[model samples]
Target: MPKHVWITRGLAAIAVGGLLAATACKPGDGTSGAGGELDGVTLTVAAKWTGTEQKNFEEVLDGFEKDTGATVNYEATGEDTGAYLGPKIEAGEPPDIAALPQPGLVREYAEQGALKPLQGEAATALESNYTGYWRDLGSVDGEAYGVLLKAAHKSIIWYRPSAFDAAGVTPPETWDELVDTTSRTLSNAGITPFAMCGASGWTLTDWFENAYLSHAGPENYDKLADHEIPWTDDTVVQTLTTLSEVWGEDDMMKGGQKGAVQTAFPTCVSEVYGQEEAAMVFEGDFVGSSAAEAGATVGEDAVAFPFPAVGDKAPVVVGGDIAVAMTERKGVQELMAYLASPQAQSTWAGLGGYLSANSGVQPDAYADEFTQDLSATIVEAGENVRYDLSDQVPSRFGATEGRGMWSILQDLLRGSTDPEGAAKALEKAASEA
Candidate 1:
């Protein structure tokens, strides 16, 4: 799962005040020029990554700075996230550049005029460089407010290759087969077939959306995001119902109902590596990195498949980060260009194995066979690669609907709510939103 960092109120106030000051001043602004450009300068960039993730970017940024003679003052947001930066941002002390994990943050800053909109050369360069989903997610009301830095693959179905081979089982082709296979495997091995943890509110919601992507197909999913389809639609109900049955049942999941509510999604990944208690985990491709960080091998020990479809549809999920610029610093623009460059994409994939939005870089070079196969699924998926529904919708609606999902899912698992009741609650939440 991706981590979302938030800005502190003090930072937000500072950011707002700075923007107001910048807006009020003339071409040659208060303390800087209107464009805020300066040659041979350094610009700060804050993000959630530290250690390996930070090194992955810094190594790439080093080349950019060396080539352009621009200095990059990189700040690791660390585990604490953007909470530390919000106050500085609100008070107009934001870094010249920052990468927000969620698109809603981009929308909020862009709508409030806290971000610098990319136009002309930069916008055209971006449009010509990334996928349509990347372009769309970074824009607010049709203007580009951010750039797609990199993407994480979210539609992978990971299984223990050796376990599946020993069980004489093959990946399922459809949703029904998937459910059936899950049950059969569990019954035969006397182990839970699926490893799912719903402790974190959004992690549980991912299961709903991933299942929806396979069942409803990408076109219909997009319709939901656009508010063209009602949440009360049969597809929505069916998807939630299917999820409840699988998640609510005992032995069907690695941990029982009690375990589901307590296990962090990342921790439950352990059930898949040589643990008969849990056999498969549906997660993003980058999950393998977490697995490795937890001392699991990538290619030999684990493998992946696309989340099986309900019928014949392919699956895709939102895979990119929205990075916004706060100032018009010359070095910052140069750094942004390099960050979105093909070289950076290659380095990111090589280091972290996440997909890149850069058109010039391909995943096959460094990605393992499973990663390669996953990329093929993504390409074959094409426009079916629906943007993450939660990120596409207004933030408030996402929060409300997400909480409703958590509450309803917990109730269904505990037998406090029936499928119909859960569906009705979700429908109500969606409708009210």
Candidate 2:
């Protein structure tokens, strides 16, 4: 979902050219001075970021270049990064680095020797900046292979302040209270309370993930993600039924379930901020940008709050891109180290539309009050943060369209299956995966 932005290519990047420079030094070595350690290095880094996100990342790259004198080429792989990276890697010509989209892919590539093991300074940087929760997401078989360069806190609900004021209802802190608020907003203000992104399968998964994490607790969430328990387990059935409490309500979704199934992801954000506005849309923090596109000013015209507590604690479902080294080339380890440090992530953190897993990054480094609070929320959560379950699971069971979590949840939204039926279908898909 972090990559699901309105991306567009802007200025051209340095082409994959020039010679591979020799390793002059590691991070903090004297060679980073003028005529720098990586003076002649040309490192190629590939990812799915473009548009403003791309522009912000280039600023991070510019800093790396200035510090190390490395000439880095930027490669945008669009949505289908594997299609672009797969052939290049198979031909024994992988880029120096790539920002893998999923934790599962990081493990697969690490197991297959497609990814190089990050050692020494890079590993140390990762451990120092991030908690075990973050470090483990980038490691395989007890070895670190990736660094989470960008992060997203997904358990956020964006709403119109005017809608809440009109209804005289404050944001709720508990699930039952949220359910009550939704009804009150509709009854008191004649507002449609929720904008559903049923058409974007991943958003539905996020909904389920938040419920599962809070209701079943983090340990069970981890087990379910690893398939240690079947999808048909009671916890999953209970979570699905909980989701239906809202989905089953005729007036809960802005256009009802059918229309929700027809709505794309961004439309869900805009529908809450545009004329004839709905009261709310529940998604990741990325919705802030989509709200802006709808002519809504973030933290003013629109505001976000933590997803209400479903059980004893609030759930934080994190989504992010992990930087992985594909080869042990000169300047690669140094770049990896920099990315794992607060210095690199903070560069983009102030530029907006980004959060860093690096705890060393101070909350004040963010652009505004909303971002500062959001960044602080993530850092304070420490090892309590969990990565996206769908991203951690096998793609066949997690991401495939017309099957897996996407199809099952979409079917659930359409009232095509009951909670138990949805659980069974998901179990069948996971077994196949």
Best by TM-score: 2
User: After TM-score superposition, what is the CA distance of residue 3 in candidate 2 from its true location, in Å?
Assistant: 32
Off by over 4 Å in 2: 1-35
TM-score of each: 0.83, 0.91
Query: 29-112 in candidate 1: lDDT tens per residue?
Result: 111211324445777988877777778888877666666656788887754334656776789888888888777778777877
lDDT measured at residue 157 in model 2 versus the true structure, 0 to 100: 85
Poorest lDDT segment (10 consecutive residues) of candidate 2: 11-20
lDDT of each: 0.64, 0.81
So what's the TM-score on candidate 2? 0.91
Clashing pairs in 2: none
| Reference-based lDDT, residue 373, model 2 | 62
Residue range 252-322, candidate 2, lDDT tens digits: 87788888888889988888987635888999889999899889888787787788788888888889899
